[model samples]
Target: IHRQAHLVEGFSEPFRRAVEREIRRLGVEIWAGCQVKAFGPEHVWLSDGTELIAQTRLWAGGFQVPSWLSTCGLPTGPTGALLVDKYLRVQGSEHILAVGDCADFVWGSRLLPKIGVYAVRQGPIAAQNLLRLIRGQPLIPYRPQATVFVCVTVGNRVAVAEKGRLVWRGYSATVLKNFFDWLYMRKLKPLRWQEFFY
Candidate 1:
């Protein structure tokens, strides 16, 4: 169940369709543009006057920040995430930087999506900028790439990959997704400075 008709927003049309197609193929019904009116022990009512009888329901809707963000007296967006400039620095604090899901980094008029991929890419750049700041050098601006690839795991064996207009699914996509996941986890392992180069 989702508010958007497309599974992934701000992605290419072909990619969004591919994700929806794979999801339906897995025999999971998708309720797009659905507004949950009410819920009962064994059923859920939608705004469209449709009652769905289901034994299980999962609410994967929206994101929120910790209450302490507001209490900290830092500038925050409507979602309560810390407002940050192009360099990922906090609005008023030169030493403090914000990144990941807790930050509201805007490019032009749009705020960047709160996704893991952006956060992963932002980390190294943020670190570099911090070093530059420490050396009294100009900080490098964080310019987000136009195209961002995303992979979604639909089920045990099914997954979807999207990069602009390109899309991939099924077993190969699942393997590719798993490979990326493994690579991410592997990088998290503690290693010596010499091991990093190797």
Candidate 2:
């Protein structure tokens, strides 16, 4: 993985270390803090003047919102995410709402990071607030939790989970991650619960 320092930043220290250990166990070389300067047909040059010979190259740097958001005439942040209020409603427009990675939710003094946890939590609040607006009722304000759960899976055997100061890893963590995935899938298809149970 081409990550700088922490494999999964914002997660607990133990969680990050566990993921690093698992990835190393899988024989995957981690070029931490090393930036790709150039790529040739058979090798890649690093920022530190080192060259790595590889056949396949995968870029897993980060993510950004679509560039078209800026062209939509919406109030966007530096990352081109639409500016949204606490209720996930677009700023200066009651009818226009934003959610998920496309929204730059203003939470207290900082904009919330683009993450699935925040998006999952924002979904219901946005739906309720939209209904309230249509019913002429008061829109409910969103209050994010102080801590969020983060899990990273390495291959199919190893995983790490972190919630605040608590951390779990190894096969048990992988099982937990799978359970969370099942829960998310269940939310999308309630009828699939039977398939999940069996």
Candidate 3:
């Protein structure tokens, strides 16, 4: 059961369903929305008065912004996301730019998921805006796309791609996903091909 780092919110539902389906296929009893309250000698006590005994426990709840972000003095919102203007510049810094997961700009005030595609698209725009700013030229506004492709692994050697109204599955999707992953790695870490390929 390996859920990659980028799976969040809507992206998690399919992965969770896949896990549940696989577990059911194996004749394993699976429970949803069961919150564990305390750890016992060899089991877990649930808030709903249920006991689950297992030798291994897998925790995959997801991660949050690093703790040190607060000490860095960046203006963070309620969820600890760094606030940035449309130009992808930090609120108080004229020259400082923000990109990737660090920028908290959202469309229509909705929070954007911290995904690779968003970061990839933002880098060039942020760079462009920064260059224009340095040259005292007009800066371009950053506009995030509403829909993005997500290729998720469903165990085995299979994968699925989901976008606005598009869905594709199986080996072809897996191959495309692998290709896209490789492309991103090569682009982001061009000089370190050995490190990325490995």
Candidate 4:
């Protein structure tokens, strides 16, 4: 279920359609442009006075900034994310950097969506920029990628992925998803003396 008209609103129309197809194929209902008024252990009540049996209900809420950030007197975006400059530094403040969901990282005229891809890309640059700031060296400005990869595993072993004009589905997309998931999970593995280079 999604409150938005499109489940993946900012994504390409084809990507969104592909994902929706996979989800529907899995026998899961799509409740777009709707809201759940309340949910009990075995049932869910919708805002339109409809109740449905829901054995397992999953609710994914939107992100919210900490209340204390408002008290800090820093400039914030419409969603209350701290405004950040190109260098990922908090606007008007040096030695303070904000990224990911907590930051309103703007590119051109719009703020980048709060997604993991942007956060992962911004992380190393933010680290290097922070170091450069301390050493009085030039801080590197973060450039949002022209085409970021997006993948979603809908259900079973199926998935959908997109990058630029490229779109993928089913087995190929699932393989790509697994490969990226492996790379991400690799970082969580502990280092050993023999594998220090990893």
RMSD of each: 5.1, 3.1, 4.9, 4.2
**Residue range 98-183, candidate 2, lDDT tens digits:** 89889887766776767788888888999999899999998888888888877777876677778888887777776776777788
Q: Which residue ranges in model 1 land beyond 4 Å of their true spot?
A: 65-80, 108-110, 190-198
User: If the candidates were sorted by their TM-score against the true structure, best first, what order would they fall in?
Assistant: 4, 2, 1, 3
Q: Per-residue lDDT for 40 in model 4?
A: 91
Please list the C-alpha lDDT of all candidates, in the order they appear. 0.81, 0.78, 0.69, 0.83
Better candidate by TM-score, 2 or 3: 2
Q: Lowest-scoring 10 consecutive residues by lDDT in candidate 4?
A: 189-198
Candidates in order, TM-scores: namely: 0.78, 0.80, 0.70, 0.85
- Work out how many backbone clashes candidate 1 has: 0
The deviation in Å at residue 190 for candidate 2 is: 6.3
TM-score, candidate 1, is: 0.78
Candidate 2 lDDT score at position 80: 83
TM-score computed on alpha carbons, candidate 2:
0.80
Q: Which parts of model 2 have CA positions greater than 4 angstroms off?
A: 1-6, 12-14, 190-198
Clash pairs detected, candidate 4: none
RMSD in angstroms, candidate 1?
Answer: 5.1
> Candidate 4: what lDDT?
0.83
Residue by residue across 122-150, what tens digits does model 1's lDDT show?
A: 99989999899999999988888887768
